[model samples]
Target chain A: MAEDALRILVIDDNRIRASVIEQGLLEAGYSHVTVITDIEALMRCVVEIDPDMIFIDLGNPNRDSLEAAFAVSKAARRPIAMFVDRSDAAAMSAAIDAGVSAYIVDGLRKERVKPILDLAIARFNAFFRLQRELEETRSALAERKIIEKAKGILMQSKGISEQEAYDLLRKQAMRQNRKLAEIAEGLVLAAGLLE
Target chain B: MTGLRHQTQIALGFVPLLDASPLIVAQAKGFALKEGLDLRLLREMSWAALRDRISIGHIDAAHMPAPLPIATTLGLGSLPVELETPIGLATGGNAITVSEELWRHMRDAGAPEVAGDPIACGQALKRVLEACQKQPARPLVFGVVHPFSSHNYELRHWLSAGSIEPDRDVQITILPPPFMVDALEAGRIDGYCVGEPWNSLARKHGSGRIVTTKNRLWPGIIEKVLAMRSGAVDADVTRRLITAITRAAEWCDDVNHREELADLLSQQDYMALPPPCLMPGLTGELMLGDAPPSLEPDFLRFGGSATVPLPSQALWLYAQMLRWQQTSFSPQDAERAAAVYRPNLWCEATGLALPQPFSITTFDDVHFDPGQIQTWLAQYAACVE
Candidate 1:
C-alpha cells in the first residue's frame, strides 16, 4: 500500500489525546486516518474500517480486545502484528514509554509506518506533557485559594495586614523548609480545628 | 547492616484478581521484607499491558498466566520475549460462566441445575447450541481473558469434549476480567471463562451463572505463575524471591488467613472489589444463582505442590496450543515450551528434591502423558472428532 493510502486507526479513550493524534496524522498528509474514542465499539469499527495500521494508547484497557482481534479476526485480509522493529530497539522502547503502540497488517514495510509511528510518539509525548501541566496548574490554583484563605485567617486572628499575613506564612514555610502551600494547608487545618 | 543482606527492590506487575494474592500478601504481610527483598506490586489494567511492561524490562517480574511464557517463547502471538517461571503462584481460580438466559437453555437441554459437573454441562451447552443452529440467529459469543490463557484452552477443551466445535459452533472473544460481568449484562457476550471475583461478581449480580470451574475442568491445573525475564535477577535474589513468595502462598492457603487475604486483595491497588467478591474463589464456596452455595475445596489452590512449576503442565498447555492451532508442533518447540517452567529453579531455591513428573488428569478420561504428547494428541484428536 502507498504511504498516504495506508488507512490508519487510532484508539485512545482520551478524546483530546485522540484528536491530537488524529490532527497530527491528518496534517502529515495521511488521508485515511480514523480516530476512535469509544472503545466499546472497537470490534465493529475495526471490521468496518479494515485499516492497515492501528494506534492504541498503552493506558487503554481495551488493548486486550485488539490483541484478541489479532488472534481471531477472520475478516482482515492480512493478519495484524504488534509493531516491533527489531533492528531499532530504541524506537520501540521510546514508543512504549511514550504510551503508544502501533499494530499493522502483517508484511507492511517498516519504512511506510516509521513516520506515522514517530509522529504518534511525538504527539503522545506532547499530550502527556500537556496533561501534566494541566494537573500542576490545577493544584497550583487550589493552593492559591488555600493560601488566600490562610491569609484571611491570619489577618483576622493576629490583627495583621494581608501582606503581613502572607509574609508570616512565607517566613514560617522557610523556617520549616517546606512548600508555601504546606504552610497554608497547616494554617487552614489549625483554623478549622479551632473553630 | 551495610553488608549484612541489603533489600533488593523488585517491581512485579500483576492484574488485579484473586490469584494475585500471593504477591500482594508478600508485600503487605512482610513476607518479602523478611527475605531481604522489597517487592513493589504494580497493578496493570490488562494482560497485554502487563506482558508489554514485563517484556520491555519496565517491570522486573510479573504474575503471569501460565501459557503466556510458552506462547511468547514459541513466538505464537507477539514478539518473543523469553520468560521463565521459577514458581507457580496459583492454580484454579477460573470458571466458565454463562448468562442466566444461557444457563436456562442449558438446563432445559438437561444440564445439572448446580455447577461442578464439566462434561454434563458441556454436553447440555452443545445441545442448546444445536437448538440455536436451526434458528437464523448469531452464534453464541464467549469471552476469555486472553488468547493464550488456560481459560481459553479449558473452555475450548470443555466444548470440544462435548462435541462442540469451538471456532465454528461458537465464537470466542477476549475481555478483561473486570468487563466480563458488564459484557454479560449488556448481552454483548453469552458467556465467559475468566478468573475469580469476576465470576463470583457475575453470580452475585444475577447476570451470569457459574457452569464449570477450573478444578473440575482440569484438576490441579496450573493457571498463574511468578514469571520473570530470563536472567533478570541473580541466583541469590531469585532464591530469596522464591522463598518469600512460597511463604506467602502458604499463608494464603491457610483457612484462617482467608478473610485477611480477601481484605488485602480488596484494597484499591489490588482487586478493589468487596471482600465478599473474593471469598468464593478464595474459599471455594461458589454460589450458582439463588441455589445453595456449592463447596469446592480445591477451587483455587496456592499451597503445597500447587506452587511448583510443573514442566509437564507446561507441555500440556503447549499441546493445547497445538490442538487449537495457535502454533504447530515441533520437537524443539515442545522442548522450549517445557523449559519455560523451571522446576529445577524451584528445587534449588527451596532445597527440596525435584518432584517426580506427574501426568495431568482432566475431566475427560484421556491420558495426558507429557512423554507421549503426540500419541495423546492423536488419541485426543480422535476422541474429539
Candidate 2:
C-alpha cells in the first residue's frame, strides 16, 4: 500500500462514469488520477502518465477497450495489473467477470499487481450493477407503454372493459408461452393495420 | 419438401466491412429463402465479438477474416472452436491511408508516383517517420480494424518490409472502421489500414488519402469468408444457407446491379453510410486524391476471382498468424485447416462447372511453397519458443 501513490487512469465514453471512477479512486486514497472521455486521447495519456493501473468503463458489447489494451500492452509493456498471466484461470475469469480489461508492462513489481487488479474489479462490478438496474427500469417503462396500448386496442375492438382486456391478453400470452410484452406488441400492430 | 418442412433458422454475426458481402447478399437477396433458411445477420462492432459469439455458439456462423478460423482452431482467441469456410466473400478491398500531414511529408521524401503501390508508399512513409521520431513526442499512432484481420497482418508486413518495427517505431491501435476517418481527421491516428469503403470515405471527407490498396500489397488475396460452426454445417440448415449465399454472390458479381447493391448496403440496418460512400468499393472506382481526385476502381471486388477459396490463400493467412505468434499451432495445422476451404460446397451451391483438377495452388506472386513453408515455420517456432 505504500510504494508511491498508485497512479490511475479512468477512461469512459460516458462523462458521469469517468467522474464517478475518478472520485472513487481519489476516495480510495490514490492521489494521482486522470479521467479521459475520448478513446483516441487514452493512448497518449497512458504513455505520458504511465499510470499504475487503468479502469475502462465500456458498456457497449464491442471490444474497443480490449483491443486498445493489446496495443498498449505490446508497445509499453507496462506492469499494469490488467495483463496478468493468462494461465491463472481463476484471476482471468474474475477479471473478465468484474468487467475490467487490463494489460501489464514490466516496470511494476508482480506482487503489487494483485491488489490493484482487485480494486479495479470491484469498481467495475459496482458500475455494472448500477447500469443493469438502470436498463431494467427503462425496459419496464417501455413494456408498460406497450401493455397500455394493447389494452386500449382490445377495449375498442371487442368492447371489453379494461380489466377484461388485461385478462384476455394475459391469457393469450400464457397460452402461447410468449411474454406479455410480445403479445401486447402483436395486438397493437394488428389494431393499427385494421384501423 | 421434407427438408423445407423442418428448416432451421440460424443466426450469424458480421462486422460491417465490404468483405461481409456474402452474408449480406444471402440475407437481402432471398438466397437463404430459396434454400429454406431464415438466416439472420447480426451486425457486430468488432472481430473480437464475432470470434467470441462463434466460439460460444451464440452465432451459428460469421463473416470473418481468412485467418480467423485457423487462429481460432489454434486457440488464439482463448477459446478453441472448429470452423469452416464454404464460401469466400470478397477480396482485395483493404487499403492503407495516412493523415494529410503525413502524406505531405512522404510526398516531400521522394515518394515515387507508383499510384496504387502500397510497398513503395510504405517505404517512403517510413523515412518520414524516422525523421519525425528524433523529437521525444509521442509515437505515431496507426489504426487497424482488428488483430486477426488481413488488414492488420498486411499493415504489419508492409511496415516490417520498410525496416520499421511495428510495436517499436509506431503505435498501432484498433479503431472500428466507422471511426477510422474521423479519428484520422482529428489527428488521433497518423495512418490506418482498413477495408473499404472507409478508406474511400476518408478521401471524400478530406481527412486522409489512400496510400495503397491491399491489392497492391498482395493481389487477389482472400480477404473475407463466410464461416459457420462445424456443428452448424452438419445440420440440414447449411444447404439452404449456402444456397442463399451462392445466389447472393452471383447477384453481387453482376455489374449492372452495382447501384442496387449499394442501395441495399446503405440501409441503416447495414453499413449505415451514404450510398455514395459505399459505392466506390462496390463499383471499383475509388477517389484517392483531393480537388480533382483520380478514380481507382479495383478498390473492392466481389465474386469472380474473389469467390475462389483457394488453399494457397489459406496458407498465406496461416503464415501471417504464425509470423505474429497469434497461434501456437504448427505448419501442419495450416494444412489441416486448409482442408476446410470447401470449393466443392461452393460448386454444389452455385451449380457452376468445376475444373478437371479440383485443387489449385494459392501462391500467385509469392515465392514460398509448401516445402519452404515447413522450413520457415520451423525457424519461426525456434525463435518464438
Candidate 3:
C-alpha cells in the first residue's frame, strides 16, 4: 500500500500532542498531513484539505466539540480514526454511528498510529461499501417493483398475459438499447401521462 | 492482592480531580483488589464525555457529576442512555475562582479580601460589571464543566442571589476542567466554577483568586456520585464495588491518609498535577491566590454517609434540571429520576449506617425541600426576575 500517498488531518488543540500523532504519520512516510489546533475552523479545514482520512487526538473532548467533529466526518464521508484519552459507552457508540473506523481509547503510542490508521481506513471502506451495497439493493428492489407495476399496466391495457407484457417491455428495452428499468420507467411515465 | 475470589471485571471512569481520590486510593491502596474485583479506572477529562461514555457502556460506571445520572436516564442530552447512581462518591469538592484582574476589580468594588460570603463577592462583581458596561471590553465569561453540574447550579444560585444575571450580565461557557486554569491564565475567561486543585492550581499559578467554595455556597450539596448503566451492574458486583469504595473513601478521609492520597494522585497515570495542589483541598486550609491559608475545615469531604446515594439529592438535581428547562416538571418523572439514587441499595451494600436522605440548606436562607421541589423552584424563578 502507498501509505505516503494519503493526505490526512490531525485535530488537537495542543501542538505538542498533535505532534505525537503527526510524528508517527511522518515516520510512516505520510508527509501530506495537516495538524489543525483550532476546532472552530475544523469543518472549514475538512472542506479545504479534502483529505483521504482524519485523525482526531483529543486528550479530553466535550460532547459539543465531539458532535461538531462527528458532523464534519459524516459530511466528508472520509474514513476517520479518533484517539480519545477516556471514553464512556455513549462516545464509542456515537463514534461507530458516525462511521468512525478506529475509535481507540487511551493507548495511542507513536509506533501504533500507522496500523490504527490502516485499520480505520479498512473499517471505513468496509462500512462505506456496505452502505453503498445496501443503497444499491434498495434501488434495485424499487426498480424491480416499478417494472412489475409497468408490466401489470401493460397486461391490463393491451389485454396481454403477464409474460407477454414483460416480453414486450424486454423487446422494447433491447430495440432501444436502453436499460430495462429506463424503458419500464418510460412506459410508466407515458401511462401516467395518457391517463 | 490475593485471597479473595472475584466474578467480574468492572471498568470505572473518573475525571482527574481531587474528588477522584477515593477511587484512586482504592486501586493504589489495595482496597479494590481485596474485594476480588478487577477495577480499571478510565480517567476522563469532561463531564459530558464521561456521561456519554458511561451511557454507551464503553465504561461500566463512572465517578459522575451528581445530576448526570438523572439527566442521562431521562435521555435529556444528545444521546439517551439510561443511567443510575448506586452511591454518592464525594461532596464539597468545588470552588469558584476569578482571574487576578477580575479579583482585583471585585476587591476595588469592595468585595472582601478572602472568602467573603459568595453573595458579597457576587455583588462586587455586579458593580464591576456595571462599570464595564460602558466600554464592554468583553462580557465577563465564566466557565462550568457541564450544564448539568452542581457547579453550574451552585454558581447560578450564588450569582443570582446578588442579582447577577448568569447569561446577560456574564457569559457561562463550558470547558473541560483542565483547560479552565489555562484559559484564565491566558485571559480568555475571567472566572470559573470548578472543583478543587483546579481552583487551588489556578490560585497557585497566580491566574485566579478563590472567591467561594462548595463549603460556603451550599454546604453538603452532594457533588459526585458513582453512576452505572441501569441494571448493567448486577447486585453482587454493586455490593463489592461499594464495599471497596467505602473502604477507600474512609481511608481517603483519614488525616493520616491525606499525604498518601496526595502521593497516589500525583502519579503520572492519575491527576499528574503536583501533590502540593492536592494538599489544600485535602487538608482544608486553602490559599486563595496570594491570600493566606484560610482554614475551611470541611473544604472537601471524602468519606462516610457522604458516599450514600440520597433520593432527596436526586430530587434536588431534578428541580435544577426543571429550572434550566432541560426537563419539564412532572410528578411521576420526578419520582422516576429520584429513584436513580438507590438508598435501599446503600443500606443493603453497607448493611449499616444508612443516613436518611435530607434536604440542602444554602447560606442565603434558601432551603431545598425535595418534597416541595416544584413549589420551591417556582418561588426561585420569581426571585430571579
Candidate 4:
C-alpha cells in the first residue's frame, strides 16, 4: 500500500487545527497533504483529490458535522484517523463501526501524528485482510457447492456413480489445463440451460 | 439539599438540534447543579458518533435518537455496547423539508393547504416523482440523517404510502442533519427529513421549505432520548442524572420558559441558531416557506412524563427495523428491544408512574402491537420496499 507520493487529506474546520495536522504530516516528509475546511462539497472534493489517507480534526463536533466526516469513511475504503476535542463512548464506538482506524480523543500533539497514522494504516490493513479472507472462504465454499451439484448432474446424465463423475470432471479439467471451478461453472451453466 | 453521593463532573453529548435543548437546559439552567452534578455538554454532529462516544466511555451519556439505543442493543449497525436511556429528552421535533424548487413542484402538483398533512404531501410527492421520470437520470434525491433513524423510517413510510419507492422512484441518501441545509442549497439532494432546528435552519438559509413535520406522520412515538452506556455510571449517579434531566424537561415544557428556552438554545454554545429558528420548534409557531406561520403550540414536548421511554415505542422501532431488514426478530427480542427504555429506572429515579404508549396515526393502515412484533412486521412488510 505504498504510494509513489503519499496523498493525505486533512479534514478540519478550524484553521489552526488544520495547520497543526498539516504541519505534522509535512514535517514527517509527507508532501502531498491537502487541508480542506469547506464542507459544502466534501464528497466532490474527495472524488477530486482521492487521498491515500484521511485525518479528521473537529473542534467540537455536532451530529451533522460528524456524519459528514463519517460518511467519508463509509463511502471510501481509505484508512481514517479521527480526532475529537472530547467525545462520548457511543461516538467512539460509532467511529470504530464506521471503520475508522483510530478514534483519538483529546490528543493533537505534532510528534504523535506519524505514529497514529502508521498505527491506523496497520489496523486497517489487518482488519481488511481478515475481511478479504472471510469473503474468499465464503466464495470458495460456494464454488465447492456448485462443483458438487455439477458432479451430481454429470452422474445422472451418465450411467455412473458420483465417484466416477468426479473423476471424469477432474480428468477433463487436467486435460484442458483450466481451473476446476471454471470448468465446473461451465458444466453447471450447461446443465441449467439443458433443463 | 441533595448532594452528590459519588461523582461531580459528568460529561454528556448532544447534537446541535432543537430537541438537544433538554441537555443544554439541564446543564445551563441549574437542574444539574441542583441535582449535585457538574455537567459538560459535548456537541456532536453525528448520532453514530454520539452513540460511539457514549458507548466507549468517551462521554458518560448523550442526547440520542430514540431508536438508537434499541438498534445498538440489537447490534443493528454500530458496536453492540449495552446502551440504554434513563430519560427521554424531547419528542416531536423532526420535520421533512424540501428544496424551494422541489417545494414549488410539490405545491403545483396539489399539495395540501394544511402543511402538516402527511397524506397530502405524499400525494403531491408522488405527482412530482412521476414528472421526474421523464428525466429519469436525475431522480429527485432525498436525504435522511441515518439509516437507522426515525427520519429514514418516516420518510420511507411517507414515500411508500404515496406509492413512491425509495431508492427506486427517488434516491434517498444519508447526510448528517447539519449538512442537510448545505446539501439542499448545493442541489445535492432535493429534500431531507431531519430534526429541528434543521428544517427551521433550512428555511433560514433559504435552502428548503418545511413541507411537513413527523408529528403529522407519526404522532405517538417520542423522537429522542438521554442515552447512557449500560453500567457506565454508578446506580446513584444514574438516578441523580435522570432526576436532573427530568426536572430540566419540566422546565423546558413550561410556557413561561419557552422564551428563556429559546434564548438559551439560541446561544452560540448550544444550537448557534437564531432565536426565531429555535422558537418555531420550541413554541410551535412554525414558519413554512411562503406559507403563513402556523401555530403548532406543542410542536415539541420538551417537558412532561414524555421523557419516560414507553416500551411500546421500542416495539414499534423494532418492527420498523424488521420491515427494513435491519434486524431479525426472535420472540424474546421484543423484550430485549423494549428493555432499552429504562422506565423501571426512570420510575426508580423519579418516583413517577410508567407512561403508556401515546396514540398515533400512520400514513398506512398498519397498526403496531409491541408484543406481536412478528405479526406487525408481516403486515408492515407490504408497505415497505
lDDT of 4 by residue, A54-116 (tens): 655333333343343443344434332343323333443444543442432223343444454
Error of 3 at B185 (Å): 1.4
**Model 4 DockQ (Cα-based):** 0.13
Q: What Cα-based lDDT does every candidate model obtain? A: 0.86, 0.71, 0.76, 0.73
> Which residues of candidate 1, in runs, are more than 4 Å off?
A75-87, A152-178, A187-195, B1-5
| Per-residue lDDT over B263-362 for candidate 2, one digit per residue giving the tens place of the 0 to 100 score | 8888887888788888778776755533244555555666666776666667767777767766655656877767666666666656775433222232
TM-score per candidate, in order? 0.92, 0.69, 0.72, 0.73
Which candidate leads in lDDT? 1
DockQ of 2: 0.15
Clash number for each model: 0, 12, 7, 31
Each candidate's interface RMSD: 2.1, 5.8, 6.3, 6.1
True contacts kept of each: 0.55, 0.20, 0.29, 0.31
* Deviation from native of the Cα of residue A140 in model 3, angstroms: 54
Error of 4 at B298 (Å): 2.9
DockQ for candidate 1, C-alpha atoms: 0.53
Pick the winner on DockQ between candidates 1 and 4.
Answer: 1
Per-residue lDDT of model 1, residues B273-359, tens digit only? 889888888999897633678788689989778889989989999999998989888999999999999887689878899888766
CAPRI rating of model 4: incorrect
TM-score of chain A for the candidates in order shown = 0.93, 0.73, 0.49, 0.48
lDDT of 3 by residue, B1-385 (tens): 2354543688888888888887888787888888877788887666655655665567788988898788777756434567788888888978889999988888899888765478788888889988998877878888888777898888887888888877578877777788889989988789999888888888778888999888888788789998888898888888888889999999988998888888888888888977888898888888753569988867888788688888988998899888766679888889888899987777787888667767688878888888998778877788766
* Candidate 3 DockQ, CA atoms: 0.13
Query: 1 or 4, which is superior by lDDT?
Result: 1
Most accurate candidate by DockQ: 1
